[model samples]
Target: MTALRIDGPWFKDERGRTLMLRGVNLGGSSKVPFSPDGATHNGDRFFNHRDVSFVGRPFPLEEADEHFTRLRAWGFNFLRLLVTWEAIEHAGPGMYDEAYLEYIRAIVEKAAEHGITLFIDPHQDVWSRFSGGDGAPGWTFEVVGFDITKFKETGAAIVHQTHGDPFPRMIWPTNSGKLAAATMFSLFFGGNDFAPETKVEGVPVQDYLQHHYIEAMVQVAKKLSGLTNVIGYDTMNEPLPGYIGIEDLNAPGGIVKLGSSPSPFQSMLLGSGIAQNVGTWKLGITGERKVDTQLVNSSGVNAWLPDRECVWRCNGVWDLDANGQPTILRPHHFTKVRGRRIDFSDDYYRPFANRYAKAIRSVSPDAIIFIENEPRHVSMKWGAQDAPNIVFAPHWYDGFVLFMKSFRSTLAVDFRTGKVIFGSKRIRRSFADQVASFKQTSKESFGGVPTLIGEFGIPFDLKGRRAYRTGDYRDQIRAMDRSMRAIEDNLLSYTLWNYTADNTNARGDQWNDEDLSIFSRDQQTDPTDIHSGGRALAAVVRPYPRAVAGEPLRMAFDIKKKTFFFEFHHDPAIEAPTEIFVPNYQYPEGYTVEVSDGSYETDLVTQTFM
Candidate 1:
């Protein structure tokens, strides 16, 4: 196998054949540790993060071969392998888990045995287990004098475990706009600029946090340095801007408007035990709208340290007035510095991404650095010096399907344009346009670099998990087909959201109620049948041109017709033959193939039509 590299707007092999990557996020549970019951809903044993192990996450070494074989059979040669900050160094700063590192290396080797290539994804949700998500270690909060146990009571965060049963579906994402995550991200990225007076152990908070994160990832690079299959490292998963450039802290924080919505100022007030009325929005088939206003955190929980102060307060953004009421001290503290307007991506995210790239390349010089913009921020301009050997890896989703938990092919809504698309033809066109726009952003802003849709897939347990009981996955298939069609329409490369080995109908990804994994255990009644455990195989398993002989003009697949079509202008200089992955799952009885100008040979054993 030859090494893959970025060349202009497409990925190329060592022989310079244009490559199209199709794969899935290895597993969803990689975000949490395998030991000590790190499931988000398990509140009893989460704080003991110092004595945890991630040896069996994704899957144990013994079970790797079976999973890998299934993936290869489904035609996934590339992977967005997941690793987390907590998985690498959960014990504390400067503490590396040699055992976990060895296990990861072994897993990578096993993946290579089955002809799979992958890039490391340092995955995270809101922030950490303590803050209702997963990524940073528990000690991260402690370093800044935050008590993890009191996060819920202080109105700083909402956790599924502490909040208990009947957990609102998809509410955990709201944490990104809440107090705890917003504050931590602000400090992590802009502590020196936004919170100048807030320090952790005398070191600037921004430097301390970024340094440790880079150091941890560097350790991963050092371990997998010479491995050809490990091509690169993602800068970070869905990096957030926090409140860095919020013109008005009193206004809403992000684009997501489902469930409880609070402004940065309101979040600060709530964390300080001030009861305030915040707007609440609800999502339906039509779209999201402000249903009503509700008073939250009225229990008077203080998400701050006892006798300690809010970091923003210590930074002089706010202070106690003469009557013991909180008052704004510097209204424009984060909005501007020295009379200059601030933009989160240009001012903060870009610098951190460059730093991460440099640190990783210091160990593996030729490694590609995958960069992602903040999920909510508008795209920023990229120049030559921003980072070399980079790939624009942004995430996209079928917003309606993801949030509504239902599929409606006839009616689709475009989140970017806020336009409601009618009919299946229009919906498919809308989705394709949205995805292509990301590629266009890469070319326009970053000098025509390669673009990979880092994350995109549908929730398998849709329509109240009806398929689990009835064994009818028609809805799931339709939803997934719409997303996959978009990928094919743009001729884009992407890794589907995930394939969790431990996915069960009851627990669903071991975090929140997100059951997007393409594989599940309960569905695997027959171990010998490779597709037994797979969910919505009709939508996921499709024919694609793995490696093209020249520049690819267009590619499409008709799932209902069981037909595949690909057209490319042959490049006479390149000797590599075009390789198309023809999955047996898509054509069980064997189907006929057609080519325009070239004679092709079929290799049934490898399932490739060359």
Candidate 2:
């Protein structure tokens, strides 16, 4: 097969045409291949538990082939090939793991053989290997004199949480260890304070690390460049804020600098080779005086550490000299530090995204660039801005916590005042507004580039007491149906939260342990029983409906009449289908409905037009 060349706005073959991706995230395959709950506290290190070791490791290559091939059979056209920075850079600084890179390439080639396009995503969790996710090596923390082992001993929330394993999609950015890792990266990678002499062989620590990160990704691209079905690249997964300003990398005043602060790397240089006067010295990595700060100590102590003095470095504040009454530092840290917002000004986001886009184009010019934006980081409009050939990949989640009744069962909350934002009507409005904003943003940011719904999904384990009591599962299903209706109305492409099990049969992270599979893992169920269903419906349906201008779509199922086989005019006002798949039951109308063919009868339970 010839290599695929993506030109202009659409994802096309050698022949130019628009393409929509129907896919699932193989999230746990590369790094956290095992279940999230079983993840060990020792970073990627093994504790011999049999469980944690497998987290994110590719299942046998043949198993991967089977998984990818099955997805193609299901009509999925793309795969978000998740690879972590640690998996490829674990050999330490400046070294790319050749064998690991090859391992990823083999999977990509196999996926292509199944006609699945690959989107290389450098996935990370808390931050790095030491921070409880597959990412940069444990040695990354050592660069700053941080002892990973000590963090585990004291139960550092950044490295290990205090209570239960906070499941995926639950840990809020403002208040987790993930934020700490981001801060460290901001300092080390973005050129914050460090000892003057502290350098990686004369190069700053941050520069060296960024170089390694870029190289690993470049290598992954180069190795798979010949694969036609490999479609795109997601540069970094869920980037978090660090100890510097949220806008530090592109702040108006400029990126934060640590001026003369003592860096651990500098301290190491002084200790090893650099000779300096011993009298005038600094005991800590930073010399700034302490002040009242809301910053939670990673050590869990209330006392302040000098290095943590620059709260603005992590929270996005600046000292003003306009009035000039006096020079004063301000407290910008929030109770939700990870929730600290990055300013959306062009000066900030444009540079941030463009940098990554440029890096991607440098390595894989023919690949379509899928850019994902955080609903929290900036407004949805942020996705609209920046780069040619970029596709906006925004995530959506039904505020799982607010509606969560127990560990298992849950429901969707009311929209406006509901607990979580994603599933509510208000969020639906926001999503609509974003679609408009993205269209406008694309014009300004990426030259009217095509966009897609990058991520969206809800859990399926709606069983047990919690599910039955609140009917949370059912409500969530209804809300999800409505959500998909909206997406379909917009004519957007999507890749649902995930594929099969991850051991914990939870939401997007399930390791294929439950009945969620389209193919039964059970020996009991007959393979030919179409009713022996896989939960593929959750991932398959496009939420909304689409129609050409001046042409509204017709209704197939009628809710008011409670019947099927009834033909009706299209309703342009409604973007999503009023009628949802209740499952199993055929349309009430006498006409036999063919779902695969979009034909059904009435008092057809026909819903509104898309």
Candidate 3:
């Protein structure tokens, strides 16, 4: 469990072995609060936001050993650990929760004891818990003159608490194109230019927002500053550009359209209390469609505070005509600056990333920075002047399987092109090629840095929760195996979507009705068995070379055969043997191994073949 450093396209250990890191997102429920039972399904909003605590997010101190031991046994040496700005600064701006910071420090220390390494992921969904996702605190919107409670009525954003139970499936993502999230993100990233008139306490919105967010993370860095296992920090999880690059505000701008879908201009009008006939969309086997139009904000509820005005209106993106109707004054306001077209990744994301990288590295100079690109968009090209020691950490998902919660080995969709490819072999190739494209992007865009699939997994409660009822997980296994093959074929490093300690069959990950977690308490039928609650272990706990002495040329594992193969050209400069993880779950009956040249020893306790 030595510290790792970046070596071009590979992560090298203290022994100079090219390390292939396999890890998982520590847990999914870290998105919400632990107290007041803030699970999205509960629909409770009485608790004060400032008084909330995240002391026991991934797990409590006493339960750390149990979760960590399980993860270590599963052969995970890395973690894309989840944290949130709300957890750090929910009390208000510059009001650091010292107790929670101490709790996080203890958690990181315990993880180090388990031989696990991790980077802090400032995880977020659309924007915040009040906006149908989780990341920023509620007060963030308040400072910018937003009333989160009015979001639901105005169709500014959707919230589980206000939306009530049986929330629409996979609809939370649509919040990105809504009024609440789009406005906040635009203000956070580009308020100086777009919302020139917008300010918080006389400070420019962009500077005011970014400064506080970066400082909140800096608090965590200061707490865990000296811990060697605290490898690095993620800039932000799935940062969106809001309306930054849209050429037309009238056109739809969301990726997954469900329920009432509004254009950027329509969202602004709705937030400003103007009723609009927004299109209602539904997802079917054929894909998304505009089923009908729904009149939103009929009661005329405004999303802004009582004394505040719409930021866009003040900036002249829209205005009230002589007839008291909102009119689009600048349809392409976000598309350009001073008559020059803008690229969201280049103009906005890169500058923020650079600022974030500088802020975090001030604590630990050698700390690696894991960069996640905007969803469905390519990362901006990096030059010699860009941040160093970065890894192109991107996210991918099988759209058909993820949303539909159904899998067929013979059928898969190329989400990039939205075309169905109907063949098992072709589907597998497409999956592998999809991952390879990211690696290629790393070479071209990020100057040949290492690539990590920050997040990807399957829904355990798939096929209408059949497994939960019948206790059969063959479908989940097949689906997970297919995904693992894609990664293994590419020989890429990755952290699986998640493992939530408190996950249940009914509640899923306890946020947004997503059941992507690989572990659930209800599935734990045997208390003594460490692997009982694990949803799909057959494909998950497979053989992988933990450390290669030189350049790894090839690697593969046969799920059916239970046979493993790995090859690498030895480095004469460093004479350390390659280490392979041979999990006992895949080999219960004492297995044998053969090497091309030298003999290897087995450590049954650690489950390693060196």
Specify the highest-TM-score model's number: 3
Q: Per-residue lDDT tens digits of candidate 1, residues 1-610?
A: 3589888999999887999999899789888889877777677777788889988988999999999999999999899999999889998899999899889999999999989999999888787877888888988887876777777765567788788877787888778878888888998899999988877778999999999999999999999977889999998899887778787877776546677778888888888778879888886766668888988777887777686667887888887799998788887888898899988899898899889999999999988998887875537878977778988888989888887788887987886876778999989889999988888888887888888999999888788899999999998998898989888888889999999999899888888878999999989999999898999999899989889878998888887888888889899999989999999898777778777786889887788999
List, in order, the clash count of every candidate structure: 4, 66, 1
Selected candidate, larger lDDT, 2 vs 3: 3
lDDT per residue as tens, model 2, 1-610: 2244433433433332234455667654355434334343222434222223232355556567556544544456566767776666665666666766676777777777776766777876546644544455665655554544433322222233322254322222312222235435454434423222334556766566666677777777887777767777875666543433432222211111211221221221222223222111111112213232221223333111324222232223333358742122333331123455433333333455566667767877766667664344423344434566667665654443222322212233322233334335555565455444544554565555665666665554543334423534444345445555555445556776555433233322332121122232332145444333344343243212221222223333232343433223434553433232222222223333344334333322222222
Taking the tens digit of each residue's C-alpha lDDT, what string does model 3 give over 37-118? 7788876652367778888898888998888888888889899999999999999999988988999999999999999999
Candidate 2 residue runs with Cα over 4 Å from true position: 1-16, 33-58, 132-134, 152-169, 172-179, 192-199, 246-359, 378-387, 400-440, 462-476, 504-533, 536-610
Model 2's TM-score against the true structure:
0.64
Model 3 residue 209 lDDT score? 96
Q: Please identify which of the two predictions, 1 or 2, would achieve the higher lDDT against the true structure.
A: 1
TM-score of each: 0.97, 0.64, 0.98
RMSD of 3: 1.1
Q: Give the alpha-carbon lDDT of every model.
A: 0.85, 0.45, 0.88
